[model samples]
Target: MSRDIRIVTEAQLREVVSLDLETVDVIEAAFRALAGGGVVMPPILSMAIEEAHGEVDVKTAYVPGFDGFAIKVSPGFFDNPKIGLPSLNGLMILFSATTGLVETVFLDNGYLTDIRTAAAGAVAARHLAPSDVAVAGVIGTGLQARLQMQAAHLVRPFDRCLVWGRDPARAASCAADIAAATGAQAEVMTCPASLCEQSQLVVTTTPATEPILTAEMLHGGLHVTAMGSDQGGKNELAPQALARADLYACDRVSQCETLGELRAARAAGLMPDTPPELGEIITGMATGRTHDAQITICDLTGTGVQDTAIATHVAARLGGAGTVIPV
Candidate 1:
């Protein structure tokens, strides 16, 4: 079949934004697809942003079940503010499950990354968060933190949102924006401890090399989503946090343990004896949140399969020849 080549600009992605509920639905469905064994997403490749000299990594997610590959790369540190460039960028590709035709291409790597990660947070919340949860706390005020908050809100109607970051001004601004967007009584607090004390749902999105959240700060039945630990040397939550969790799931156990929050726990020999993938939980091969007071956590370091899933979703939404192109 002959078709005209159509291109979608970043403006198009921005226009076709899936805020909270839509993001949750997309994410849950992606997990469902993955758990069904039709989707194959592999671990992401990433490195810490060096303050002086920047480094990058290339990661790929292949769904052999789906017969496609989604690869990603983080390329820039964007040190010069005068250039007005972003710190992250990449492209996503999708092939036909059967015919192997080029199905789609997502040039907006940063956008795709933020949304997919947020969606994963929602997936975790769906499985781990209490049905009665009303307050949520965010430990970071960056891009990932915003996505995490949005995704968590879709899982439940948050009556309160507590946001705190190293940069007080950024936290205050983010809190104010969240309040207006979700209509939740939001507060820009100091740090994680106070928010942890009051909220049942907590998400840590900081890219910290040192531990930010201590063991004593956590309470029972608190659903924590660890999204920050995506590199070998970086970690936020302490190993004790994992020791206390009743149920723990990750996008990919191998990847998470090597680079994500699991890295910290495993280093201290405090990692779970039995850990399951998110697909296992989504497919009912495993269980999540059996009791009301059980602590649960999902280590989401990001996956290539999700990047593929979201890329496919975007291509489907943007019709015409947005994906099929001659190289």
Candidate 2:
């Protein structure tokens, strides 16, 4: 009998990063699949990720009714200078798609968390980014930043990429690394605001509490993906940026209103009453980009649908690699 099965560890995550070339495809496919219909996904619930100045804490629930585990690996604990550990640690407790029973568990928690997230970035680019988009701008230089940049390339090639990070040295170095990895000319931007000024497509992946992207910096026709504000109070987009968007889409409105970048805009009465859902847009129920010059924004709050999609994809790919032997 096929019992509850499958688990992936950290080493496997590293292996998949190198081994999986079709990762962005999986992500894009998932969105299309979601937009195509027939999948059921519950909302994700997460507590605030914060604490006293010296401490860090984050608790996230993958779905309502079905219990979930949020495993986060902290930063600043890396001993080695070159090969650092993942910032968020712990595996996801995946319940069965059919029965809501805890079927498979994965130990390579952050790695899976990341690629799926990056895939969402791919989804945003596919539906929103301009056909002529040739320059990609990314803020933040961490793992999430890397995945987003990589995923965007999978959707379409960029003539050049610009990066901005808190750490100048790391930013420049990471740009070089990405350039080498993707065959795209990449460099650290002289200023973070330059991202909005120069690039038509931009993504912000930082964990900033205050607004990092001001509307004053934005140019016309920029498609923005604000993915870092998965938790409440962690906002990356400024109100001006939201105001600048001609079309604003989100993974889910309920979650985005309560936590994501949409929260701030909603609080200020700047966001729309009926912003389109990403799924609806994908399904052709709604429009994505009506005009080429319209500014668009998509806020991602890490949903259970994406998690389950990744889990299912991983299981299919592994093909009994982690299946348990019968007793």
lDDT (tens digit, per residue) of candidate 1 on 56-128:
7666655644445556665646574446766666665556667666655566756877888888898888888
Best by lDDT: 1
**Candidate 1: where is the Cα deviation over 4 Å?**
1-6, 38-52, 64-68, 76-83, 99-103, 321-327
lDDT of each: 0.76, 0.71
Q: Write candidate 2's Cα lDDT for 157-265 as tens digits.
A: 7878999998999898879877876788998987878777888788899988899988887766788899998767789999778878788898877778877998988
CA lDDT of 190 in candidate 1?
78
Clashes of each: 2, 4
Give each model a TM-score. 0.89, 0.83
Prediction 2 TM-score vs. true:
0.83
lDDT value for model 2? 0.71
TM-score of 1: 0.89
